[model samples]
Target: MPDKDAGTPRVFLIRHGETEWTKSGQYTGRSDIPLTENGEKQVISSARLVVGPGKIINPSKITQLFISPRKRALRTYELLFDEAARHKFEGKVEITEDIREWDYGLYEGILPSEAKAGRKERGLDKGRPWNIWIDGCEEGESPKDIAGRLDRVIAKIREIQGPYMHGEKPVDVVIVAHGQILRAFARRWLGFEIGVKLPMMLEPGAVGVLSYEHHNVDEPAFLLGVNMAESEE
Candidate 1:
């Protein structure tokens, strides 16, 4: 019998592991923080659970990898794949700013409550609270700015997967990036407006899958859950 899962491609969206700012609930855009010790442990454990042959993220099948420019995200990528696994994607990896975290601007290194208070004190968002999705940050990127860049990334992914969708070859793509940007990418993957609040969240050192339904690239959908493979002894 023919393989039922042929042709359809999968995109693995991975959020980088924790930093001190992430632990403290601070906005960590463009700060280039390194992962905490616990953060490295988290990604190492996650790699063992989700990556390998016959696993959710099989390295041999991956065709492309887009990584954020931040050090924390780069560290997560290093921990997720060993030297042997890295050789599998020799010419396919890209370190792009397009996948970097949202530019939090003046809100960088501050908590949400602090950001809100600052905005209020500045005579901004007078009646309502500050929502990053809608209001954005001072001297930072707006929803439109984010959408423009992410849309380009999405287009590139689609272009890469288009020719392989009906073939027997695997066109799995991987993205290693920050939490907020990955969430936004998911929203845009399904043609959602960035300004609209979506109840989506990605914790540090976690992975989410995006794929099409019925082997049709036009039908983009999220894999809400998947059973993980047991770790090797």
Candidate 2:
């Protein structure tokens, strides 16, 4: 039987596993990088944590699984539910381009430090952010772009939530995408201003859950949690 939690379609947003480019601090906007071995382990662990019945999340409770077309995200999706057990993350894996990493444009595949130093030498980093982590995006993407895409992907998820929503919507939705999308998704959906200036990072295979009380476009949606990663030691 499917489990119902407080009568709402809880969404679990996760960042993909680590890649060679990610380890070097390069901007991986739209780049398809495969996960490291450690990344696979991390995905399995996080899956147990969130999708198990012992926690607030359950796999069967997850009606849909949306993934980024990138290799890292696709790998995470496969590792989490490779065999598809009844009690585990057994769901359809769908791909959404809107839920992709921030498009760095000309800056993709370059290290953050190198970009900053070069931009600084060229006086482009002045009044510009160093890392996308705390300072926000500079050469890659604007807040409007982030906000716009987040809005679209989230709206798409909300529409899918109508059928499997249990007593809430239609069904529960679980999205496996990138860090930038996860951060923006949580911020916009939860309506939190605490970390607006900071770009959020997720451990490869980390999970962030965003829940809401029905829908009220005027007021804040409500933030359930963020940056929950796997302890694959």
Candidate 3:
């Protein structure tokens, strides 16, 4: 059980389930895709295992749910919580652009290998490799832009949890978004800049927890490498 007296707040960052693009390792930004059949099965099992009573995500404790303004994310959110849980949530779902996937621009709908090959052909990868974090895409938003947008989302999270931070009621939020943006959001949640080489993997249908150490919001931290077996309890 969590320390209620410590005034801890948590955010459950969930990557949307696999899509055709995701299965093929294609960049899926701004292209609104649906989940594959396997992806739906995977999310159903995961949701039952990790989001019920005493689970990693307790539906009753969730205050707000932010979903990416994409069908993939909205569908994932739908599958993760059952009708009962959704009713308990009382219409807290808000589809926002803030949590959308990184704008891959010219690289959209292509694989990373293809992007690299194209850059290499243009002699753009001559130096230190084409890093999306630093170099960005030819027509995409920069790392700085991602940082700024996510910072606002984090600020809203803090504001939402503020009233419950004094040990009154535990507050929890959920974000259903894409892989790259959620991973970057996790890094920013811990006060780190986006990286050219992403530091972590947030697999499709995976759930990650971000919270403050010792209930101090100033000491934000990621619950790294959490074991799902233990979370099942």
Candidate 4:
């Protein structure tokens, strides 16, 4: 429904279901965190929402499935078909690291409280901003670095779109991935400023359908929908 006739692929970007770290608000990056029980339930419901009632995705229309090689994302993709309630997505699937989760350095497994406490304990919170993206404290990644990586991913997506976004066919692309990285990909692909204070909201087990329309000046990428999780219903 989101402009597949214009050679623009209707990309369905879904973040994997929740993990223990996700529930605890920890910075889950690169670490392999399995889906929680509720998270698996979310996948089943979310898949039904996407493939059935929502009617957002057409299986035949889907040309390819791109995924991050991470465990969580891989499991999410597997659940899409194996889950009893979500049999509609039995389509071809492929994995792509270009869509992998962002690699957070020293801050990878640290819980939010520990981070804040450590900051105060060191007496550095006064001068530096507390937020990770804005501050980029210590060995962690700065927004600038993330924005740059996102740009590379965006460039790859654009390349796949072909002929500078002038391809003439309807295509659907499904990307199974993690939260923060997928959000960054969507933001960068839409030409949003990198590392802005306001970030796109892409919850676990959430699906974001993006419509890319080629215009004379630039290809306008609009969000057909964002953060469509089972929790919403």
Give TM per candidate: 0.94, 0.75, 0.91, 0.77
- lDDT per residue, candidate 3, 167-186, as tens digits? 56757899999998998898
User: How displaced is residue 144 in candidate 2, in Å?
Assistant: 1.9
Error of 4 at 71 (Å): 1.0
**Which ten-residue region of model 2 has the weakest summed lDDT?**
224-233
- Residue by residue across 89-195, what tens digits does model 2's lDDT show? 44465677777888776568887677677767777646646655444455567666677777886777666764543344335577888876687777877655424
Q: C-alpha displacement of 157 in model 3, angstroms?
A: 0.7
Candidate 3: lDDT of 173? 93
- The candidate with the higher lDDT, 2 or 3, is 3
lDDT of 3 at 225: 45
| lDDT tens digits, residue span 56-139, model 1 | 788877889999989999899999998898987889999999999999999999999998888888889877777788777799
**C-alpha lDDT of all candidate models, in order:** 0.87, 0.66, 0.84, 0.69
Best by lDDT: 1
Which pairs of residues have clashing backbones in candidate 3?
none
Candidate 1's C-alpha lDDT? 0.87
Q: What are the per-residue Cα lDDT tens digits for candidate 4 across 1-233?
A: 65343444667888999999999888887788899999888887877776632356555455567888888888887776445433444554556666777667766888777877887877877966587656664676666777886676556555555543443443566788988887777777677754565557888887887766552214647655443421110
Query: How far is each candidate from the true structure, as Cα RMSD in Å?
Result: 2.8, 5.7, 2.8, 5.3
- Runs in model 1 deviating more than 4 A are 1-7, 227-233
TM-score, predicted candidate 2 vs. hidden true structure: 0.75
Off by over 4 Å in 4: 1-8, 52-54, 82-94, 123-125, 162-167, 214-217, 224-233
Q: How accurate is candidate 2 locally (lDDT)?
A: 0.66
Q: How far is candidate 1 from the true structure (C-alpha RMSD, Å)?
A: 2.8
Candidates in descending TM-score order: 1, 3, 4, 2
